[model samples]
Target chain A: MESTRPKWPWIVASALILVWTIFPILWIVMLSFKRPGEVGNQKGFLPKHWTWDNYRTVFRTDLFTAALVNSIGISMIATFAGVVFATLVAYAIARLEFPGKKLILSFALAIAMFPVVSLVGPLFDLWRDLGLYDTWPGLIIPYISFALPLAIWTLSAFFREIPWEMEQAAQVDGATSWQAFRKVIVPLAAPGVFTAAILTFFFCWNDFVFGISLTSSDRARPVPAALAFFTGASQFEQPTTAICAAAVVVTVPVVVIVLAFQRRIVAGLTSGAVKG
Target chain B: MAAITMKNIVKRYGDGFPAVNDVSLDVRDGEFMILVGPSGCGKSTLLRMIVGLEDITSGEMLIGERIVNRIAPRERNLSMVFQNYALYPHLTVYENIAFPLRLAKRPDEEVRRRVTETAGLLELTEHLDRKPSNLSGGQRQRVAMGRAIVRQADAFLFDEPLSNLDAKLRGQMRTEISRLQRRLGVTTVYVTHDQTEAMTLGDRVAVLRKGVLQQVGSPRELYEQPVNLFVAGFIGSPSMNFLPASVDGTSLSTPLGRFEMPGEQAAAAVGDRGVVLVGVRPEHFEDASLVSEDKRARGSIVQVPVDVTEWLGNELYAYVPYEAPADLAAQLRELSRELDSDQLRTQAVVSLDASSLIAEGTEAALWIDTSRIHLFDPATGENLTRDEDHAARLTRAAEPSRAAQRSTQQPTEP
Candidate 1:
């Protein structure tokens, strides 16, 4: 029945969704190329005069440059720590039969669903008291905590898909339990690990609430938070074009990462581990 | 290679259910031993216990001289081939076979030398660089065996390793595994539910029933002198047919007809019981027209209407349905279910020469070999006609040849 249906209706619906989601990104790219004074003219969707001057201004500013460095450092550190901890926790959840396993899983899920806005006020006061305000650790801690539940959930699911016999076979082949996990189970769970790491990195990179409320200066301010503090070259002009350029810069890495690992993120790595 | 001995090995799960209940067996050095039974019979559980994957609840498991009940699987040094051929998908065939050696921290040159030799023995040289996903089921199974053989472990355990292959490949791999086991001369304990594999590959076979060992013997002994009804029914294909019979002096009254047994045979079969079950192999019944007069004198003849006949070129099968008593019919049904067969009715399947003039819905004269028939006490399911002396002699005869093979191959062992 599906094969007999006309193809154009599906094609038309897909094109509509594509444009609805992609238009804002295309508009931002166009706005980034427009002249600084041209945003408020309201003449057309495309720029009347194309220029690289806004991009140059974005790079020349000390605030945006330092925030970019902070964003990369914090996101990378948080992703690494989150994935390492999640792998161990998820393996325990998937393979071991311990008491309180269900409680731990539910608690992690409740924490994931907890509102970020509610914690921002308490965390801000706590960071200040601990002398962690306006520091990289201030933002990194929350990013890792938030990223962990998601990473654990994804990794545990992948670990469950692996056949138990693979590890048993390895153990019978003379591998210690640790070696069985590191050499056999870890390689089998690589796709899940990669997917979890990418998700955690994105979560840390795109967070706004903690990035904005936790830090007061460029010392630990990420790009998403720094964008709100941008100003024009002088009092008469607006910073819309320069902000658009900075948005494009941060968005590039996310796009490249998804594109590069699209296969690994989606492929089921345990396909040939056992007969299906 | 070393002998593996299980002294009353028992495995109980957390729920306090004994999955393997007091199974004690001896796997001699450089011998191929098979554990066979229907599903859920604890054959695989026993194999796992031998390899230290499942902890023994109470018993001693010894590989060579060490009591290994508390030893880890890696420390026990026995490799296993899983039913699904659990090859590491991420590794090449070469690396997959070399995994154990690498885990042992072997040097690069030795790992290379041993893996190449094992791959060559398994005929996996051309697939050295290919991942397991790219290989066929048979190739993957060979890679799994290569991995087990490369370790030079104390023994090898196989848990239905060829169950996943297609029928033709299964036959080929069966012979290959048999040949490999013979060449390596490693003590092996293979678990399978398939009786044909049990009959063909093992130097000795052990049959289990619901976590209890029923009988362990040479396949010929299990066939000719089964200790009980379960062993008789489980060992044969187109298995032995059971018919309820009532004994009167030297004659037996069955659903088919009355047959006279010799005096000595009748005394052994009629042990304090008026009613007994007679077990007859399918091939023991022959078409009356095809039998010689002298041979016919040694057996009884019965005339029955054949309900169905199937000709398989070389032989013919004639199904003769009969009216069994209600209680005996239910008993046979339960036995059939336990044997993994669904026999819907009480019928005798008689195998005859293909040239016999037997057709559906026709009365045919079938000769039953009275000398070969077994009588069982229906209440206890015990074989009244079992000859223990003969069974022991059969097993004893097989020992010397096995010892000869081991001694001849000793010089080749490194």
Candidate 2:
């Protein structure tokens, strides 16, 4: 354990990554509280005059507010549906004895491993054919389809580490497999399931290309597409602080959830490799 | 709470190779039976079958006269304690113990009462609110046991529940689980590879090897009169010493010396003198006068040159190279067992008081009582007098009385 200073190379590497990755986030946060005059052109490491106006201005925009509610609403719904469907599929694929179980799991993994860029055109065509384009369900259905596969793949790995004996113990104690899964396995796998939810939430929430391509109306558009609509042609007349403030809302929730679950998330991600 | 019987039980894995083959046993109401074997011998597989966690590939399993081959594990109402204790890490000790009762839809008051009572019994009352990860291995084992007894399950199945503990704690928990099993008396079936656990805790131990039942008997029965070569070698610590010997006329001769066989094997000898396996327990040797020319004496002794000694405080086990005949290695190998040192050098051990210790690399004959020598068939690996088939047939035809097994067909009182 003391010799875990084998961590030196990784510590240095992670420090470099932390500086690069967190720099923009820190910059955005710093800009969000800056006065309008410092919106884009302002220099200096710290804000000269910090105020709540950027936040207030972003909140006052109907476009930003609608999209905020839409993003939260869609992401939360997608997360819920993804967890339920994915957890069932994961437990089945991991624990149940069935024919072609491996193939079904491989298919889910293949979907995850497959590039999303390849599906954008095909999925867009299908959505247009189904007349779901420019709608909330339009956004939800495809996001769920994509999110479920990854969620199931990850959650199943978590479920596999749990001994089948615990379920057998529960079953012998009078729990049906479903009841055992819900009452016993789910609580045990909450940290893992939380990780899957967080990832799925961001998969849809931070999506700009798909969200913008899928919806064109305020009624069904999410915050990402709504924020994208503020740009004219190739650029926008909107103040940089307003965009920075929107970026804060878009990125902060995921960042905070990930930070809170950092330990669990690390364990969950590597859990697929081998048990520690 | 219930009697469990397995009639010709067989379990084959998905690949169709048998994990447990044609095993038959019975557990009387409230009896504690242990299924023991080396790893991959399928003792745990057998236990899982009894709990309905694994399907019986062949034969019938009855719990209280109900054939439960197709029944679910939960429906069998047997609680299992896993090797890792399998305690729910997210739940408190109290909750883990009460999990079964809660599943039964018992009132919170009832659940709380049972949990508290069980925790108090295990002396885990103070840890009731702590999670399994916070508890020590022994405490977690107690919690697993408490969960088993807290519910009125028809039976208890333990899959090496004490294996993960340290050696000292393993012994400690062995005593505790034994006491708890006796007190609860819920028809427990424990699986373990540790022979000491098999010997110390079980009412009757079922020994398995390569998916075959070797023997099932009390600890003393397995030690004093194992049915076959496998059981004899496996059941004892510092396992039995096997040396190649032949029946030369009325005497059993090896490089050590020719000694008289007990009367039972004497008749079986019948002048056939190829070679045979001679088993001598370490403790069977005594310090006799180096010269005992009267080989005709019914009770005989042998000389052993001391080699290396292991001092375990209370008793010392001395390994001796008795320099037996050249064929001893062949006999052990033929029997699918090995003790290579007995080749150009044969080995014997003497369990004695630590004070009377002999220094290593010395020539001294520790007399072996010839009457206690067990002669075995080399090719068949069976005790010559009793053999595998005869001991098993006798055990099968055995009545419930201890006398049935005491000196079975042997002309002796003890």
Candidate 3:
């Protein structure tokens, strides 16, 4: 709407932001394709000698493959669990009337704001004592707990945006309570659910503190934690390029998810939902 | 279709404040009943209770002979149109209208046929495949109407359905709804806060104020013989003007002038020589030059300078501001507040004929019809010149045709 302003400022600002965000990922991808000797001996930002040796080495490791499977399986389970529970809680918070409703919202906010590192020490001690250490449930349980507040807050805002009269009209049109929920409300909330699932998956996928603190082996270690334990093809070889290859592989899912749901995520975050 | 009857219905919230207080009314079979009032008057609360969406704290609700207090909304066999249209955003017009039939597990063929047929009735055949989001406001409203009518439920409840539309579209939809109701002969209970909608759409309109039923009568009855000051000010377009008056024998003293009160109207006044409100509709006043000499002699004429005049094509409105006693001004202020209208001052509007040429700043002779004047008690806000029981009787008289039809096995007569 401010058409009088020069257009160059926005183009320059956009280029600066793109460089700022993409520089690190580009460096990692460049390193992933570099020879082991050339990684620490970089002549410039771009790799002088490129090879598939690092990617071959990363894919050939049992530990890396095992951790990749663990990360995918655990993050998916946690995302599903968190989103399902969040939907119920969000629906209650958004639609139903009860005492202490504000208290519930405040509680969710407090948990979301709570520092994850502060809970790591206690969680580590508890997991070990309960024999859940080095297990998939150990990581998944914390992932769900941490992801719930985000999912709940986002999903609840989305639920509140829906017109309540549509639900009542469904009932008056001869749908029972459950039918009304399934037939009318659920389809309307599908976009919000997708948005919540993506966010929860991203949270669980990118977690490092819980994965490292709770699991000592690849049995439950996610890719972020597993990347630290990567060894080269031999004891004398540096594993920097192999680790970079693994990091690049792990970032693929996040990129794919972001690209697939960029528009929906923007809508979910910005949808005030009060308009007709 | 069924007649809806409420017996001493009360809707009290959790805090024990009654939103709808001990209200009782019967909506006859196939009759268009309008529940109208200002916001927070409990008209919507009453409509919600009938549809089983809100709990009736203590009351008996009857759909024909069956009590529906314990029934759920779906089981109560009624349909409702919301002010927002409430159409499912995900469904096409065909699917939206077919939803109830599909819910009841009707045959797929039957659902398709009925949906197409209903869409045709609402003139939505061309947009049957379109979602609610793709349609315009008026089209979406019609789709909502199609959804309500597809199943032929026991009754249709409309909660200010036309309020979301523009004035022109609202006028169009109003006549469409009236035509649909007449063609279908479906029982309906509509709730709206607009007095114009209430006056035009209802076969019988019930006016409410502060959770109590103020008056229930035909539009003509409520307009011509209001039960109280609130109804008088609430019904008409340029609402009836209330001026402080004092009664002494047959003649009433008002800020405008002294006019002879008819014998029947004077007898309706309660105490002698007490302050009363004299209400005269705007249409009852005209330019003295426009009236016959014989008719002009039958009423009082007041010469007042017109502050402003509006020529509205069909009629002309002139505003005549006067000075009233402080107590009377305060009384009119309180009366306007109770009516949910703007604060009233010492103003009288004389709706003269368009040809009268009553220009502003000029003194105009305005003849008032003394017989049509309504007298009211300032303290109680009751109409002293209209019988409340007569208005009630007029409303109740609408129920016998339905009752007679229910009692006989013969087919209903037109």
Best by TM-score: 1
Worst 10 residues of 1 chain B by lDDT: B405-414
lDDT of 1 by residue, B216-288 (tens): 9998899999988999999988899999998887788998888975458657667568899999999999999
Instruction: Output the number of the lDDT-best candidate.
Output: 1
Tens digit of lDDT per residue, candidate 2, span A1-276? 567457889899999999998888899898877765665564575688887777777788888888888888888888888888898889888887899998987888788788777778887888889998887788888788889888988898888888776777778777888888888788878877977988898898887767777777776778877876553112334577767788888887887888998987887787732211
In Å, residue B87's CA in model 2 sits off its true spot by 0.4
DockQ of 2: 0.50
Compared with the true structure, what per-residue lDDT tens digits does model 2 show for residues B1-414? Answer: 899999999998779899999998998787678898767788888998998878899999999989999988778889888887777777888888998898888999999888898998899999998988888888988988888889898988999988789999999889878777766656889998887998877778898986788888777667777766777777776677776777666666776777766775455653475677778787676555432557325456555577787788887778776554445565554433332122333466577656554667776556676666677777667665544554455544433432333224233433
Question: Can you list each candidate's DockQ?
Answer: 0.69, 0.50, 0.67
Name the regions of candidate 2 deviating beyond 4 angstroms. Answer: A1-19, A26-57, A231-241, A259-267, A270-276, B269-273, B289-298, B322-331, B334-346, B353-357, B387-414
My TM-score estimates for the predictions, one after another, are 0.96, 0.87, 0.94
Q: Output the better candidate (2/3) by DockQ.
A: 3
How accurate locally is residue B153 in candidate 2, as Cα lDDT from 0 to 100? 86
State the DockQ, from 0 to 1, for candidate 1. 0.69
What are the per-candidate TM-scores when only chain A is compared? 0.95, 0.85, 0.96
Candidate 2 chain B: 10-residue stretch with minimal lDDT: B336-345
Pairs with steric clashes in candidate 1: none
